[model samples]
Structure formats: structure tokens, C-alpha cells
Target: MIDRKKIALLICERLLMEQEMLRVNYINTRDSIGFFYIDNLLPVAIATAIAESFPTSSEMKLKKSLKEDKYISAQMDKHSEILEEVLYAFQDPQVVNLIAEICELQDIYPDEKLYAGGLSLMEKNQFLSPHLDNSHDKERQRWRVLNLLYYVTPEWKIEYGGNLEVWPNGLKAPQVTIESKFNRLAVMATHNDSLHSVSKVLVDKNRCCVSNYYFSDEPLKSSDTFHVTSFRGWPQEKIKDLVLRTDNFLRQTLRKFFKKGIVENPHYYKKE
Candidate 1:
């Protein structure tokens, strides 16, 4: 069984080797939805082990609504131990600090509770509509600074449709698609304007990702303000867009009156 320390070591070594190039890519995209991805992030054997250990769709919790459709699980103990090991490896101090330096960010911290973080799987026809992630952590204490997604499904293709879509120029403009390639780790800066989504899955296979988010004492951008995870439909879906907009507005409004909202979100780990 791979442990967090070993996984973190492999990840740090890979990031250090590609540090310069990743820095450049991130800087160039900083004006938009700044991000970078590293391929072959781990040894093929280790990557394969992690990928193969993923829990089936039924073993995870399904999140289905107008905003998104996917299977997610933050309850690490309920699934394969490798999944939890890989997930927390990204949270290791050395790994987190190294990633922050590459992105030229400071004061960033990893989420231990895995709020909206953990394992995610998308099956046929499932999708996450374009939206900004909720700006803060569970307690609304820290600003969600970066989104770290490590795709592990072997040979997942671009045409399969479960790719990461960045609407850097806004929803009406042509969005950038980041393939959910195997053994690739994608890190993206998240702020008020960092709008992104997952394209619908078109094939029968599952697209699996080990996800984590880093938070900070301050916002990524000076102008960023508190907001809910706002969702919007594709440009052509006028009615859906309107409905989603209204939904976003209502949720945002509720947050103002109730700092944490009416109910507690059940997506975080409940360690015993």
C-alpha cells in the first residue's frame, strides 16, 4: 500500500522537475483562469495502483441537480485505503508549500476536512455546469485559493467528454478544455472569476479524479468577494440559464442573511 509520504515525495519530485515550465504556463494564464498541468505525475505502476483502487460509482455519493451530476465521496474510511492515501498526499506540507511557490501564491493551506474535496467520478451523460466554486471553506474562515485535480483513469480520451472546461473569457466566449488524462495533475487558481465546469461524459467508462482544494488567509485576488457556488447553463440554453441564474441569486441572498446558510453541507469528511 502506498503511503501519503511516498506519494507526496513522488509528486514533489515531479513538480520540481517541471517547476520552470509550469511556472511559465501558470503566469501566462494568470490574466485569465491561471492554471497548469503536469503529465506522468507518478510512476506508471503507482498511478495504476491508485486508479485501480477507485470505488465504484454506487459506492460513492451521487450529487445530481441543475448544478451538476456526479458521484463523490469524502468519507474516506468507507472506501479503499489507497484512495484516502492519495487524496491526503496532496495535503502534505511539503507538497502544498511547493505547489504554492510554483503558482507564486502565499499563505495557502490544505483542507483537512475535504470540504467539497475528495474523490469524484463522472459516468455517461453526467456533467457539471459552468460555475464558480464556493469562495470559502466549510466554516467560511479561509478563502478557497486553488483547485487541485489529479486524474487517474487510464487512457481516458478527449472525446469522452469528461474534460475540465475553463470559461476564462466568460460563458459566451470559447472555453478552454483540459483533458482528464491519466496520471496528470492539474492545479488551477480559484477566485471570483475562475469559472469552470466538467463537460458531459459521452462514453460508458467512468472518469475518476482525486480532488483537493487549498485555502488561504486572504483572497486570491484583491477584488474577490464572498459568493455561493454560482452555476450557469450553456449559452444556447436560455431557459436553463435563466433558471440557474435565479437559483444562484437565491442562494447568494440566503448566504447574506445566514452566514453559513440554512443547512450544513454534508460533503466533508466526518472522521471518528
Candidate 2:
């Protein structure tokens, strides 16, 4: 069993401590992305144990098109018992309450479907392109509002790559990249403007982190116009960007009629 209360207190302490750290807010009114740096988020002992449990894989499987780039999704239902416990620790009422308090979210709930959850591992040359997440939940009953990413790569340095990048002003400008520090959690609002991606894992080591998305009845913003989760490429990946944009157009267009996009995004849990 996970001690949700202790984890929540720890998170609150970190948030208060980080009030003085560098805070990055979305540049334009376009994106709702924000970054708060948390140091030593998970206890050293717990982080080390979790790191040891990470499977040593030469390569990742099941590449899914997110935005214009490809990613490895974590299937919550299939996770090991320990991993599931650690992941659920983030969903505790206290932890959720702290996140809501820090990000100022209203009526937040854990999406058991986990639209996109699990460990995202990127090795040398592997990269994720900038893109917005789908705006609605799996069933389209609730709206996707926040993205929660917790990094547990111990002793990982900036040179290792796998930094979190936020392109608040669309693809034309330089993106703000934040190091995926160990035992740190990055929570940001996900709206039509929340354009984000993971930089290519530059070093030989694998960059791994746990992820979860939260949903609510209310959208992130009242005036946040309805649009599909859009994606764009780096200034160099022109061809890839064009293809991805077209793909997004088709999905969003279908969403207008289907409400749940063209095909159901099975990023979450499925019934047996």
C-alpha cells in the first residue's frame, strides 16, 4: 500500500521550497504550459529502488504517433505490483490536492484510463516532437486539463539529454528546455496552447520517467477555444511537421462530428 499522506506532504514542502527557484510560464497567451522545479521529490531510498526495478531494454516497442513524433506509452494495467504502487502514490488524495493547490486546478480526478501514463524512456537519437495532447478524455465525457510527469533518473546529468521542452509560442520560436532531474515532478496545464515535447536522448544512457494526465469537468480555460491536440516539428523537421499537421487536421475534423476524434485513443486502461 502507498502512503498517500506522506507523499502529499513531501510534495507540498517541495512546492513551497521551489517558490524561489526558476519558474517558467508560457510566453504567449497561446499555451497554458508552466514549469516548477522540484528538488529531491521522491525520497532517495524510494527513488533508488524504483530505478533498480527499471527493466533493462535494448530497444523500446510500440511506437505511437503523438503530435508529429513517436513515443512509448506506459500501460497502467500491465505494470508490476511495485511499479503500480509507486505510480498510484502520485494519485493519492493528498498528492492530487497539492497539485491542484500549486497549479490552481479545480475538481481534479485521476483518469484510471491514464490517457498516456507509464515510463517514457528515450535513448540516444530518440526524440519526441512538439505537440499538444488531445483535448478530451478517452470517453469524451471529461476534458483533459493537466499533465503530471515525475522524473526518477538518479544522478542523471543535463548532458544526458531527455530534457522536457515547452514551445509556448508555437513552432517558429526556440523552445524552453528543462532538465529531467531525478526525484522531481513537473506538472503543467494542458490546453490547446500547451505545446510540448521531449528532446532527443543525446547520451548513451536511457532517459526514463513516469507520467500521468489528470482530467476535469471544466476546461483549463474558459475562453480556451476548442481545437485538436496539434503538433509541430523542429525547425529542421519540415517534412515530418507537414505530415503530422495533416494527420492532426484529419483527427480534429472528425472530432467535430465524432466528439472522440476519429479512432479512440486507447492510451488508457481497457476492459477485460
Candidate 3:
């Protein structure tokens, strides 16, 4: 069972009460990177249940590459009942609309198919390089607008790493660190220049999060342009950075000329 009633009750009680305040704060600080987080997003008991139910890193698919080491899976049927319920709770239409109001976006819709939105598990040494998400869905119809991240790992701390870093002024300036605090929810706009990444995890334990993205008919910025999921290494990784830059340019060029590309992206859930 999805247990949406329970999820809805908690969200309505905890998050809906602060919608207007969050809207003002989100608008006031949205010019660059544009994000805000709410701690203790759900009751501690529910959050603990979700965290305890998360599949181990070994159970999820290891997306090992230069960009990240996290385990990600969109196949909800394969996970525990509570995991699916909590993941989709963010997808609830009312919840989606409320978040849209907070982020000041219109006609935004949650991705029920879970394309690039699902469970994420990171363990020791896992990290995600700074990068801009793909500007659109797998089919390029709707513009990917907002990234909704709900961290559920219990007792997670700032020092544990895996914190989200946003580069509002590009990579040269110091980044803003948003700790992946347990039971916290982060909403950040995703567009042409929303460069962000997760710092490497230092502890041996696993960090888990439920992620979802909202899409719209129009791009966030009128000047937004289409692009592939671009990546760059840490500031000190001079050579890797250069290589990734070249790689990004090539991918962008390919995407511009070939819209959907020769082969489809394999990241989406292939429901049977």
C-alpha cells in the first residue's frame, strides 16, 4: 500500500503550514542558484522508518563513473513498500502544487515515471561532481525545472560529507553548502547554469535520499538553452576538469544537432 493518507497528513501538518514563508524566502534568494531547505520535514518516527527501510548500497545499482559513485534505482516495485510510498508522497498532486508555489513555478508536474527521480544511496568515497542536469526530460518535451531532494538517513551530519554544493556565481566562487541533514527537504531550481554537486562522503555509513523533479512547459529563464548533463571536476583537479569541459562541449554539440541522440538515455525506469 502507498499509505498516501499518512504521508499527506504529515506533509500537510508540517510543510503546508510554512508555504507562504518559504515562498517569500525562496523568492528573495532565488536570483542565483535559487534554493531553500526545511529541516525535520516529517515526523521523526516516519523519517526513521523510511531510513531504516532503505535498501543497502549493494542492493542498488552502482553508477560508478567520473561524476558519481551513488547507487540509484527508479524501479519502485523492487523496493520496500514504505520506500515507494515515501518516494511518491512527493509526487502527490497537492504536494507538487505546494512546492511549485514555494519555488514560484507554473504548470509544473511531478514525474510519475521516475526518470532521474528515485532512490539515491551513497556510501564511503561516493561523490558527485559539479554539473548541470539535462535541461529536459528523456524525450525533450518538458523542461526540467526544479529538483526536490528529501534526505532520510538518520543521524546524518554536516561532517559526514555528501552535502549538496551549489555554485551560484559559477565554479570560481566559493560554493554554498547545504548539509544532507536527516528529514530535511531541499528544493533547488534546475536550469542552464544551475551547477551543483555532492561532496565525497567521509564516513563508512550510507546516506539515503528520495529525489524527484518537477517539469514545466516553459524553461525557468527565458534565456535558458538546451544542454546535456554537463560535468566538471573539483577546482584542484586541473586535468580532469579540462577533460570534462571538453566532454561537455562535445555532448552539448551533439545534443544540439541531434535532439534526442542516436541512442536513448538508459537512466529511466523500465517498468515491465
Candidate No. with top TM-score:
1
Q: Measured by TM-score, how close is model 1 to the native structure?
A: 0.99
Q: Against the unseen true structure, what C-alpha lDDT does each candidate score?
A: 0.95, 0.69, 0.87
Compute the lDDT for candidate 2. 0.69
Candidate 3 runs further than 4 Å off: none
Superposed on all Cα atoms, the candidates' RMSDs to the truth, in angstroms, are: 0.7, 3.2, 1.4
TM-score of each: 0.99, 0.85, 0.96
TM-score of decoy 3: 0.96
Total residue pair clashes for candidate 1: 0
How well does model 1 score by local distance difference test? 0.95
| Clash count of each predicted structure | 0, 2, 0
lDDT of 1 at 34: 94
Per-residue lDDT tens digits for candidate 1, residues 82-184, read 8899999999999999999999998889999999999999999999999999999999999999999999999999999999999899987999999999999
Q: Give the better candidate number (1 or 2) by lDDT.
A: 1
